[model samples]
Target: MSWMTLSLTLIFVFIPLLLSKTLNLGLERDTIVAALRSTVQLIAVGFVLKFVFDSEHAVFIMLMVLLMIVAAVQNARHKGKAIKGITWKLFVTFVVIEVLTQTVLLGLHIVPATAQYIISLSGMVIGNSMVLAILFINRFTAEVETHRDESELILSLGGTPKQSINRQLMKSIQASMIPTIESQKTIGLVQLPGMMSGQIIAGADPVQAVQFQLLVVFLLLSTAAMTSVLLGFLSYRSLFTERMQLMKIDVE
Candidate 1:
């Protein structure tokens, strides 16, 4: 029996029970719904990836990046609606981080100048940073609400809005980065991370795949850290008014 067939069969057979167990952790319908949605989405994406990889058209790649941006922006907005302009903050942050990471990797001759590589690289940054945005924005908004009095105190005491919110913004950025930073520390010892494991299972050389996964982890760390800080900074500004007064940082 082929390993691929067995793996695929087990994936289907096991995921639902796995999801049902995860749902037992008080997520209610979340794990079941999310697993189902992911199954469908990944199947659709597999075909889309086939097309994106087949052609090197600049327009097609640009569209894929745009879709990524849209996803990130929407996620940010959903998380940070209280302060407003979270989408714009995330959009700007991604534009800067994604372009810089993609450009530098190409410029440094680290990655092949291929459409698939570029798309995967950009998608990795965009996708992973979405996780950071989700964490930071929600916590930032929650922290703002939790410490509203402290924030207002600063504003009332002649502190500029930036000065008032500086600490909170920093904390949010720090919180967003901790998971990625910790995961990297635990990669080989604590777990076989998804990418390297997948590559090795798919017949790639183990050593080479480990190296590639290391490179990928570093890329994600850089991108997500930078994006978290930048978006946190920008989103904090949106929590203030034109006169440097703190606006209601309440989550909408």
Candidate 2:
């Protein structure tokens, strides 16, 4: 795409800005910042990825993946700050998701060991994991806060921390995963996913594009489940005191 084509895309950004201003949503500045940030970040990443794709060094690929995970963890941690030590919890969950997904992809020979394939697929896994982590954290925190009395009652009745929060745990995990599950139900019929659309626009076979998009969809399903369950288990304990009493964090 040329500069002219890129300029045309700004109309989409302008629509958001116009709506924010007319509605008095006070989001015009944020909308502008997000558009500018996305442009700069994508362009910078394009250059960096071009170099890494050319290098094809295993070390560089590993480093890039690590950086992506760190960034993802940091972003997810924002929603989890009420839980102590949330960063490490998110980090571990993301790493596990990343490794497990990539292992299956590579082991099954579904994708080759190339920089482009690895980086693009890793981004998908990391991105999904990060969002799931944020969802889980936000929902979990809200559930605990809303049910603090019930939790404390359970504790007073001699229940363990896990037992006290078991319902909230399950509910939060289910809530966090709903978006992924629902989206997959209508994926091909309702939407052409990014990978598939890009491939088709680049003149690839529609059949081939569908196959790859299916791979990504399946990977996302796995990611959604793994991230929610793992992070839910790992972070829930931090919500309780050493005496198994409910520890409340101030809700925003």
* lDDT for position 243 in model 1: 84
lDDT tens per residue, model 2, 110-154: 899899999999999999889888888888899989998888898
Name the TM-score of candidate 2: 0.94
lDDT of 1 at 210: 87
Reference-based lDDT, each prediction? 0.80, 0.91
Q: What is the C-alpha lDDT profile of model 1 across 47-83, one tens digit per residue?
A: 8878888888888888989898887788667767776
Q: Pick the candidate with the highest TM-score.
A: 2
RMSD, every candidate, angstroms: 3.3, 1.7
TM-score of 1: 0.86
Q: What is the lDDT of residue 146 in candidate 1?
A: 77
Which stretch of 10 consecutive residues in model 1 shows the poorest summed lDDT? 23-32
- The prediction achieving the highest lDDT against the true structure is 2
